[model samples]
Every structure is written in C-alpha cells, then in structure tokens.
Target: MRDATAEKTETALDAASLVTDMAKRARAAARVLASLNAEARTAALRAGAAAIRAAAPAILAANAIDMERGRSLGLTHALLDRLMLNEARIEGIAAGVEAVAGIADPVNTVAAEWERPNGLRIQQVRVPIGVIGIVYESRPNVTADAGALCVRSGNAVILRGGSEALNSSRAIHAAFVAGLASAGVPADAVQLVPVADRAAVGAMLTAQGLIDVIVPRGGKSLVARVQSDARVPVLAHLDGNNHVYVDGGADPEKALTIVRNAKLRRTGVCGAAETVLVDEAAKDQLAPLARMLLDAGCEVRGDAATQGVDPRVKPAAEADWDTEYLEPIVAMKLVHGVSDAIAHIERHGSHHTDAIVTEDAAAAEAFLSGVDSAIVALNASTQFADGGEFGFGAEIGIATGRLHARGPVGAEQLTTMKYLVRGTGQIRP
Candidate 1:
C-alpha cells in the first residue's frame, strides 16, 4: 500500500521542476513566436485543431486515468465531472482552435496614432505579452484553450493544471506541441507542468521577472491564493457569485425562462446565476419560479421574503450572501425595486456577470450603468457571460480586475500597446 500524502508530495515536487524548466524554455520560445507573421500564426492554430482531433482517443484515455484517481481520492462529483474529457470535449477544444484561427490576429494591430508638432509620428501598436503562466483547476479543456490563445497572440504559455487532471493536461499539451511542429513553430511554445504538486503553483506565482503575467482560472480559493502569493501581475477573479434580477416590469415568461436556463442549463459554469433577485411588486411570482427551479432539481436557499413565498426553500444564512456555489443551488431574494436590486449586487456580487430582466428602459439603463461588473446583461441570462457569446471565439477566462483588461479575456486583451515613433532629423532646442 502507498501513502497517499507522500505520493501527492512527490508528485507536486516533480511538477515544480517541470514547470520551472518549461518556463525557461517558453521564455526563449517567445522571442521566436513574436517574429512569426499572421499567416504563420493562423496556420499554427489550424494545425493545433487538427492535432487535437487526431489525438482524441489518447486524450480521452488520459482523462480516464485522471478520473479514476480523482474518484479514488473522494473528489466531489463536480470536480470529477470537470476532469473527465470525452470525444465531444476533445472536439470542442479543436473547435476553439478553429475559432481562434478565424479571428483577426490581435498582434501587430495599430491601437492608436498621433502626430507631434516636430514632424514626429507616434503610433501605438499591439504586441504579445510574452510568457503567460496559467494555473487552473480540474477543467482539462483550459489546457487547449490557453495554449491556442497564447500561441495565436504570439505569447508562449506554461500551463499548470490540477493534480487530478495531470494526465489529461499532459496529453493535451502533447497535441498542442505536435500542432506547433506541424506549423514549423517551436514545440516549446506550449508547455505543461509535468508534476501535479500544489507547490508547482507557488513556483509559478513567484516566477516574477521570468513570467510576464500569471492568469489563474479556477475557484476563488485558488485564484485568491495565487493573487496573494504571486510576485508577478495576476489577472483573476476572486469569485463568480453572479446574479440575475427580475424587475417588476419584466416579462414573466421571459424572466421565468431566463432564470430557469441560467440556473439549470449548467450550474458548473462560472457565469451561472447564483442569486435570483425578484422585484417586490412581482414578489407573488416567486411561488411559480421557485417551483420551476425545484422541478429542475435545483436546491433553493431563500431570504425571509423568499422563505415566505416558497416554504420548500431553506432559510439562507449570512454566509450564503457571499458564496459562489457552483451547483444547482441559488440564493433567492426579494428587492423593493431596481435600486435595491443594484445595491444588493454591489454588496455581494463577485463582479463577474449580472443580468436584469426588465421591460422598463429606465430601470434597465440604471441597472446596466450602475452595476460595476465585467459583463452586464439586459433581458438575457447571466450565462451569456462568455467569450464565445461576445464573438471573441474563445477566452482563457473573464478578468474582473479594472486594470489592463476586463470581462472575457480574449486574444486582443492579452496584448499590450507599444509606442512606435518616426521622426525627421530634428532635436529639441
């Protein structure tokens, strides 16, 4: 019999070594990737898609190994579900590559330009962010998504996925490298941390000057830890406790439909609605809405007003207000009006995505303008908070931070602007 703790510790150490080595290689590869033309980059993305599709069987097999280990370790069904990658998921990764290929390359675009009085022309151009270190959880799909987006944007990527998904991540990384080779790009452009140790994350976070940026995509705990320990710039969200407000002027049919789909369509997604705010004037509608959620097998935690409306729901604790329960359970509340609803969101929201289902233009405008969130929706589901939905094709994750970027962090968001100045022979007098 093996000691699980020791096995986990050794595995983590191995991962740290792998990530540290890969980071060095990626830094060198970034210089080469930066010089490639748009056509060459697009070709690489297309090749990546083809490689992922061709390696679906191997990817699935690797996922199976990770899944088996995860279950034996008593991982939650949610985590296990995220770790398992099937043929369809493999195809989805391929589709992401294809989508990235179609989009205009963000690199080399002119962000802004200006002419100075002294015959000087200054132009701001977008450039790759260099080496991007991504640390994520059980979702194996992120391996392909982050790898492709970084490559397309001319940045070398180093991915460190969860210990439970190590095999799956490695298999995906292999396909990505093959894709890079098919396009004649350096295989080191996409690297996966070999060890699955938690310490690997610390190594990644502290790789300050070596790594340009560290983007952690996972639960709040992982992101928070990275934010605290990271020496480099971190682009992450503390939580995804999103919300949906059904205003009094809302179309009952539309509100009911959006709420149901938002909560039940897929509770595992970060943009899934965790709280439902109903207008006080429309409080009576709660009974029917609560039934819909319950019928869909969702567990409802309600405030006093919600508990009065739906006796089936349990009383919500104070902690529930600030929770990001990525499950089929939602916090239900009744608001006096739009202002009240906005206030509630401002206080408890994770600034991820918030939607308002209202027919009143004034109320809708107020909600959209007042809410300080990355994605604000009107007459739509909070689940629409996705890069694909925004027409960016695919995204590494949504950035809730105000600096650098916000919302769905696509390829364009991954770049920084540089000033290119052209001047005649003139000196300042």
Candidate 2:
C-alpha cells in the first residue's frame, strides 16, 4: 500500500500545480482584457454589481458559515468582524464595484506628451500591469474590489483569499464570472485559487514570470511573507500603526470626535488610529479625550502624563508605540509640541496614515510635511484615508512603500506607463 503521508504530500504538490496552471490561464486572459475598451469593462463591472445584489442571499449564507467557524476557532473579535458580512455590507460592496465602473478607465490615458528635437512625437501613456496576484485575509469584499479594479484597468487577476473567507470569496467570484460573461470577457480574467492549501501561496509567490505583481492585503505576517519570499514585485504595507496628533490650537470638540471615530468606528480596518498624541499646551483636553474613550468602552493605554489624567488609563509599555492594535484600544502620549509629535511618529509609526487636528494652518502644514506617511490628514479623521474617500472607487491596498505606487492602489495605480513615440522611420542614434 502507498504511504498515506506521501499521498498527502502528492496532493499538496498537485494543488501547487493547479495554482500555476491558473496563473498561465490568467496571463492569456490578460491579453484579451487589454484589448477591451473602457465601455466594455464598465459593462462587465456593472453586470458584476447586479449579480452581487441578486446573489445576496447565497453570499450571506456562506458568510454565516465562515463566521461560525471563526468563532469556533477562537478568532479575535476584530478578525471575526472582518470575516462576517450582512446584507448592507454586501450592498456596499456592490456599490463600490459600480463606482469603479463609473470612474474613468486609466488604461491608455496620456499622462504626458511632448515633441522631441529630433522630429519625434513622444507621449507617455498608461497601460495595464498584466496579471496581478492578490493574497488577502478575512475580507471577502476584496474579492469584488480587486477583480473590478483589475478589469477596469485592463488586467487579469488571480485571487487567493484566506481559508477563513474561502466560501464567501468563491460566492463573490461567481458574481464576477457572471459579469465577465455578460460583457463577453473571458471567465479566466478574474480567477480565484480553488484550493486553500498554503502551498498555493508559495506557488504564487514564486510564479514570477506568470504574475506581474503581487499585492498582499492582510496583517504584518502576510505582507512580510509576500515581501520576503515573492520573486514578483510586491505592493503592500506591513502594518497600520497610524496616529492622530491633537495640536495645541485644535478644537476640543473636533479632537474628541475625530479620535472617537478614528479609533472606534471600525477598529479592524487599517485606517483605525492606534496612537493619540496630545500637545502639552493642550493638556486640559487630554482628560476630556481620555474620558470620552473610556465612556465609549475603549481601553486606554498611556504614558505617565496621560495615565495621570485618568485612573482607568493603563500604563503603556515601549512595545505599544509600534503595535497595530486592531481593537478598541489606543495608546496615548503627551508631546511637547508639533515637532515632538512628528518626531515620535517618525520613530514609531508604520508610515501608513497619520493625522493632525489643528486649527492653526501653519501647525497643521508643519505636521503634514514633517510626518512621513502614505496618507497625511489635516483636521480630518484618519479613517478618511481610503480609496473611496479619495474618489478612486475601491483600492486593492494602501501601498506604504515609496516606489512605483504610493497611497491607495486603485485602478489608476494598477497601471504602468509606457512611452509611445511616433516618427516616420526615426531610429535611435
């Protein structure tokens, strides 16, 4: 008889082979997608959105199973929240897909044009980045967002969602397929890996020639693995240790409201503020802000000065400065001024998103310029650091790395620029 362990190993290898085959199919589909016009892509997205709305019952049923499994596995409340989806959330996801369809297609758009001295007309135009591999965790909405964005930008996508959301992702992917068929696009254009094996991720990471770019949308471990092991270029952020600084000139009411919403509105999201920096000059506001958080059922972790303001505040350790608490918890510290806040964020922040609540334009500008993050807000909630808020419809992820793309990875960012030079048989010197 064949060894059982060996058979399991063979099965895993087969799963890897399956993933590679999907990558190849996606590469071929990308050519077809690239030839499609903006109108055709929009039609496909709209079809997908309609399919999602029609399939809400089935999608929610799948989500319920995932939620039950998550609870049994002892997942955190935040993680479970990311996994669960209801009718309203599904509708929102569909709307986001429609919004992407409404946005102007980025492919073939002229970014720059000029005439050269050598009688040549040079124009820089955007083009699709070919096949993209999206490895995400928990959120099934990413299934719609990533597929729609890739289709809108004229690229094919291969999605590999976490096991926790496997059923919901498949349900959502079916909607995408229906949309593609409605628009006469290839079903392979947005293929999701069928197996939940870890080997599939490894195969995707190594499929350098088949996958043009890898975008990981998950926690630090997931992003770190993709960045470290993937042969393909990665566009991702390791963490969202975001911050909100209450400047001396900030309105107390604004600070309170922004902080409350930024931290507690939806704690599991990447835009949630993990740290609060209060200007020493605004010491009086500290107690009020801390009290508000306490009243809202948030656990406050603070330094000596902040802890002195409220007895409910727990003492913060050094590790809290660099942690991304995806929960109803926040770390607070008092800064000497804007400069101090900037220094602290520069040292501890994950360069995701940071905000300043200040009525003083100069102070706000200083904070905005000094802090090095993907998204910097002035008197705004850090939660506004989203692609939809930026009018991009939906985002694949927020790229914290400063390279080909930064901030939100939307349809426009999914494309690369190519030089379209026209001349009558002009040759290089």
Candidate 3:
C-alpha cells in the first residue's frame, strides 16, 4: 500500500512537470506568434476554420460521447446544452473563426504617438500579452474561440477545458493545431492541456511566472475557484446575474419582444437575462410579459408586485434576486422607478451585463451611466453583450473586472500597449 501511494505521488509530480513544461513551450511560442506578420496570423485562423469544418464529423462524435456522459451524470439541462454540439454548431464555430481572421490585427498598431519638445518621439503600440491560460467549462466551442482569438491577437494560449468536454475539446484543438502548422506557426502557440485531471487546474493557477494571464470562462463556481486559487492574474466574472429593466417609457411591444429574447433565446448563455426589473409606473405591462414568458415555457419567479400583476408568477425567494439561473427561469421585480432599478441592479448584479428597455432619452442615459456593469445596453436585449455581437469576431470571455480588460474580451483585449521612444543622441544634462 505504501508503494502504491508513492506511485500515485510520482504520477502527480509527473503531471505537474508536464504542465509546467507546456507553459514554458507556450512562452517561447508566444514570441514567435507575436513576431509573425498579421497576414500570417490571419491565414492561420482561416486555415483553422477550414480544418474545423473538415473535422465536424469527428467533433460531433466526440460531443455525443460527452453528452451521454453528462446525461448519466445528471448534469443540468443548461449545462447539457452547453456541452452538446452539432454539425451546425461546429459550422457556427468555424464561421466565428473566419470572422476573427477578418478583423484588423492589433499587434504593432500605434495607439498614440507624441513628439516631445526636446526631439524625442514616443509611441504607444499594441503588443501581445504573451501567454494566456484559458480555464473554461464544458463548452467545447470556447476551445476554438479562445484559440482563434489568441492567435488573431498574436498571443499564445494554453486551454484547460472542463474534464467533461475533454474528448470534444481535444478533437477541436486538433484542428487548431493543424491550422497553425499549415500557416507555419508553432503548434505550441495554441495548446490544450491534454490531461483532464483536477490537479492540472491547480498547476495552471500556480503558474504565475509562466502564464501572464488566466481567463476563466464558466459558471460562478468555476470562476470563483480560479479567482480565489490562482496565483496568476485572472480575467473573469464571478457571476452573470444579468438583468433587464423595463422603464415606464418603454414601448410595450418592444419590451415584450426584448424580454422574451433576452431570457429565453438561449438561457444557457452567460448573457441571458436572469432578472427582470419593471418600473412601477409600467406595472400594467408586467402581466402580458409574464404570460408571454410562461407561454414560452419559462418559469417566472416574481416579487409581490409582479406576482399581483400575473397569477402565473411564482413567489420569488430572497435569494432569487442574487441568482444566475442560467436556465428557463427568471426573477421579476417591480421597481419604484429607474433609480430603484439601478440601485437593485447595483446591489445584486454581478456587474457582467445589464439592459434598459426605454425610449425616454433621460431615463436611458441615467440607467446607462448609473449601472456599474461591464456591458450596459439601452433599448436592446442583454444578449447583445457577446463579443461576436460587438463585431469582434469571437470573444475569449466577458470580463467584469476593471483591470486591463472589460466587457467582451476579443483579440484587441488580449493585447497590451508598450511605449516605444526614439531619440537622436539627446543627453540628459
């Protein structure tokens, strides 16, 4: 028994060493990636898109295995939805890659240039952020999206997807590797940790010097663990308790449509609305909206005022206000006005995404300015918070943190700026 325990310890050490080595290779490859011309990087992404399309059959098969396992594990329907991938979804992922390839390369772009009085010229130019470690959950599409976004921005990435999607992520990552090779970029530039062990996640979190930044993409638990345990800087949001507010001036028709799409279009996505705040002045509209959601099969949990408006609404518990349902469930509340709505969101929101459905310019401006969130919308569905919807091709993830990056983190957000100074033999004295 002692020998067996020692063997297990040795295996754990081997895995840690392997992960460290992977980070080292990624750092080296990052330099190569950053030096590559924009055209070369774009070619790699385009090639990756093609490769993914070609491998759709294999990817789907791998997804099937994961789906079967998820079902047996009694994973929630929302999670199952995130885990399942069909041919159409594969095609969508490929299209996202292609879109990213078409975006303007951020590397070497001069953000600002200034000339000093003493004959020195200073330029702030964008550069890759070096190695980015993405630790994500069951969504295999994130593997392709994160890899493409990093390559597009000239940053090497190390992907650590959820264990449940290991087979699917591996299959998708193979396409990224093939594309990188075809474009003459180092395959190590975009690598997925082949092991699914939980210990590997710990190794990634502690790789401070090796990984320049860690981006965690998933539910609150995953992001919380990464944020709390990671020795490296993490770009992530702890929760996406997103909210949609219907103002007194909101058009009844538009509010109903936006509410339906925001909450029910795809509840599994992080941008999906979990809470609905209705202005007390517009309380009359609540019954119709609640009925619409219920008719569409969404379960509505509401405060007393909202429940009074609609008999179908279930009484909401206190915790519902702070919850990210990520399912076909929504919490509804009646706010005194725009100010109360803003206060409610600021108190319970995850600062991820929030929306205001109003035609009143003053109310819209107030809500937009008052709400402290990464992405705030006016007269639009909160689902528009996506990086793709923001026209960046694809996103690594939505960062609610106020550090280097925020909102939909695409290729541009994956870069950092450095000052480049040029002087012709100027002496300090």
lDDT of 1 by residue, 50-168 (tens): 99899998998998899989989998766777787888878888998889888999998998999988889999999999999999999989998898889889999988888888898
Q: Candidate 1 — which pairs collide?
A: 12-197, 15-195
As a TM-score, model 1 comes out at 0.95
Q: What overall lDDT goes with each candidate model? A: 0.89, 0.94, 0.92
Residue lDDT tens for model 2, 115-141: 988889999999999999999999999
Candidate 3 lDDT, tens digit per residue, 140-189? 99999999999999999999999899999999999878977898899999
lDDT of 3: 0.92
Top-down lDDT ranking: 2, 3, 1
- Model 1, position 86: C-alpha lDDT score: 84
* Candidate 2 RMSD to the correct structure: 1.4
Report residue 276 deviation for candidate 1 (angstroms): 0.3
Worst 10 residues of 1 by lDDT: 11-20
| After superposition, candidate 3 runs with Cα above 4 Å error | 3-12
- Model 2: lDDT equals 0.94
